[model samples]
Target: MLTQTINPTYFIIDFDSTFTKVEGLDELASIALAGHPDRVRIVDQIRDLTEKGMNGEMSFAEGLRRRIELLSANRQHIDILVDFLRTKISDSFQRNKQFLTEYADQIYIISSGFREFIVPIVTEMGVREDHVYANEFLFDNEGTIVGIDEANVLSTDGGKIKLLRTLNLSGDVYVIGDGYTDYELRESGLANRFYAFTENVQRQRVVQVADHVAASLDEFLFHNKINRSQSYPKSRIKVLLLENVHPVAVQAFEEEGFKVEFVKGALDEDELCERIKDVSIIGIRSKTQITRRVLENANKLMAIGAFCIGTNQIDLEAATERGVAVFNAPYSNTRSVVELAIGEMIMLIRNIVPKSNQMHQGVWDKSANGSFEVRGKKLGMIGYGNIGTQLSIVAEALGMEVYFYDVVDKLAIGNARKVRTLEELLQISDVISMHVDGRKENANLIGKREFDMMKDGVIFMNLARGHVVDIKALVEAVKSGKVAGAGVDVFPKEPKTNDEEFVSELRGLDNVILSPHIGGSTEEAQVNIGHFVPSKLLEYMNNGSTYASVNFPEVQLPKLGNSHRLLHIHANVPGVLAKLNSIFANNNINITGQYLKTNESIGYVIVDIAKNYSEEFIKELKEIDGTIRFRMLY
Candidate 1:
């Protein structure tokens, strides 16, 4: 066996409020209270409850129960809430989504959340659903709130610490987040680095635990391994970064001797195909689509990165077939999003949008008639995954009660009760928000019938998918007074250019809030995306690693101590292995240990031969037929 040398580095991430823009549970509350006047109070309570639990003042189970009982919510509100929550993902996380896809097998989410949300979101990020290890929630035969998977690491105290030790990672470990639970990774010596992300709200306990503190993700990356690494040996690595990826991520790649290229917005399939021909690394956010055609044209691509939380943009099967590795910064921008959702929920609950518009328009219409408090309100959730569960805690702090619903049952979080159906959540909530996944079936999820289910004069918001709601129908609903007000962060057809003219069906409407889909566009979030994405991309290119990869078959090759490593990518056929063995035999090469792994179409073989093998030996192997490609990696 080749002696194992120290590998460069590794990362451990928290799922809920790290990479995504909003706390998943907070979005659930937003959905739950869609049209209710009590929305703001519920959010505050959840937040406070979470803080109390993290500080070791209360049991997680008890804290959760207290918050849920306060909410007094049900199923109807959850359906609409699911879509809103789903849309609150961060741009940074979306941009680096490829890192997880390309390296699907290596990246993991050790969240204290439900699989109902994490599974869908992680799968979209190109991570195998099975790779996600988190708490599971179950429902009864009649679809009522039930028990949780007590054995899950997330449900257990210091569970992430235990899980990391079991991994026995060959490389160094790093952790990033804004919560006390995330800080535990460092306290337990499971992580070599702990980055405190402050783009969202920063906790004193979490800050104290972090080894490195960053205001923006960009600043953090600048101080880390990105630009300060070794010099390039070849023509600089060509990099393409989409808008969602922070410039810092590109800078990090450049630090590793790469030539970084930037694009400020989304790209169509054809455009991506055209731009990726000479690129070694491709990084994008949620809006940039990397289809099968894009993968086929990536002749020089060593890795693809989605700098955001999701990798649904890229065609994973296509990238795998072509052996293109993908990566993403799963936890890099989560706090930013969660923070935003919390802030938005407060803003909406206090009737801040209408007042803000009045102030901006120089009206100064300080009317107390419509303004209200979030305290004592019921908050509902649709997908009680990472952001959802975290939001549940934050909401409790804001003095709000919380309830959640998932198509596939999930664990109760922070006293948040689980509801039976989406319809029940809608009927009970005063404010309804969405936090569902971007599945094909999720298209047009909120239509005329669904909107008609909510309480009249309720606040409605969607931070989730542009495709989930029928935009025109939403406009109609708002106009007809079915919804009291709306805060929409995403639109069905947004302009590609930032300076382009924007027109919307809801324009000229009063008491309606419209955002530029910047829920997680904080400076802190950009910096994290910048810092995390390039590191993942560089790791894949410099070493054939699948950590944080979303595409290609997951493979983590052992570090070869003696250097002469042969990489073979061949068609998966019966004779290929025999032919490779014969080539080694005829050349008098004494192979150390060879690893063979095959997928449906290709077989990847790594052989460690003597460092001083003759040039003729390589030539002989090159002459073998059926070898798709053969070369020395290092």
Candidate 2:
């Protein structure tokens, strides 16, 4: 933390779109016009008016009058709107409620919105009701909102400026809002600074003229050295996404206020080591290898997101040892991989590849000598995981008999039957596809011996890991006519990038399909993996929720409430939890909620406690024995 330097005597904050996440009158219109046929259009019109007033596109008083006339709201609607607005507080302000309580006297709720809705929300945040300043609403005998009180200066243009001048606040007053009028206070030299608050919304015209742009209240507080809920601002967390991960992942990271550095291609080990030193979170697909050396250099790495299904390119043991949580889209791309297998099966059985090639060479070979239909054929699946099960259903839909064999017993899907052994499936299968993972023992799982076990002219496909299949043995099988046609998506020594050349012995084989490891490269699959993997990484980073983490103890978490949350990752050994509990007891720390989960090698603990602690307490926790990584979030 930096030393306190920039201090202001007063903080003037806006109500709608700054303190809260939505415009006040627009929400009122939405509630008042519920079930009305014109609700959407009227609500949208109110929102447009709100935008116009904020941007100075129209007179503030005119916009306010038009919006109030459009809303047929009463006191009952206002009560419901207040309740909804309480839950719709901007995330940054909600997290920094402690700061608001501590400095309530210095903070003023200044806005062009009404005091009726603003007072209830700001008072709950510990702001004094007398300190709140805004426009007043007039209600008739029936408790229906008629219009704003015209006697108030806030009901006219230049309202915020006029209100600030009449109050004549002393010392340096800072303004924080999302509207052009908020900038007018600083422009008129009545305030020290104006921050275009954009946690809820960003008006570019206002942002362009402001002294600074604050993405969140935490950012503004951090820069000014005000005591905030979080020890470090989320803006400081740097995320490095490599290997052209989908843009959806980038958008997710940016939305969390984390600094994102995107690399279109994979980096080598040396390059990655240099770049990983300051990266808090890293995302990658295959091709980028995360070795032990790289993890050692990743001093600040909290989590790793594998945007693909397999994590073979990452060093899971090294990551676990360093207390780095690793996550992957385990089942997000399952459908895409299964669809590719089905497509390849049809193409291979129908001899589509050789026929296409022959046509491209200006030779018309229309004879159906070796072609066969996939219907009524036996389809064998080597693994019974997510991809295998989905493939079984699709293959059965094509009138094919489905057979599968896995080391772990799995329930059959649809008409698929589980064979006793790999040899049994291979002997009985007319078309075989591999879907196993990339475990060490699964290397060369299919070689000469396995190929010899299959019946003559068997159709083979391997969309699994490259090392699982012996390419040389597969080539010999194809040459000797033992295998009719084959589809190989992965290769043992594939090129690192699309620009690099792909060298394979199976390239020129007749009726063979050799793809560049694209079994799950469909657009739909990438988009799904893109959303799934980053969500896991962000959840782990934000709330200590390690659900579905590939290498860490799984502990799903709820949203953090009024207390502080502490996350501790340590070696899974005896006495660690006791030591943690003892430290908490000795330091007089009150634990509100506690959770602990452990794998064979690592233990994860989440504790929500009273938000009072000294630096010495933090130091003690960090120095605890077997502790790997520790973080505090609010």
| Winning candidate number (lDDT) | 2
- For every candidate structure, what is the RMSD over all alpha carbons to the true structure, in angstroms? 24.6, 5.9
- Candidate 2 C-alpha lDDT tens digits along 398-436: 999999999998999888999998999999999999999
Candidate 2, poorest ten consecutive residues by summed lDDT: 1-10
- Relative to the true structure, candidate 2 reaches a TM of 0.75
* Cα TM-score of candidate 1: 0.58
Whole-model lDDT per candidate: 0.69, 0.90
Error of 1 at 496 (Å): 1.8
Q: Show model 2 residue runs off by greater than 4 Å.
A: 1-8, 14-91, 94-104, 109-213, 223-232, 254-257, 261-264, 360-364, 396-405, 409-428, 448-453, 493-503
lDDT of 1 by residue, 238-327 (tens): 888887566677557654545578888887888888888888788887788888878788888767888776676777777766667778
Best by TM-score: 2
lDDT of 2 at 516: 86
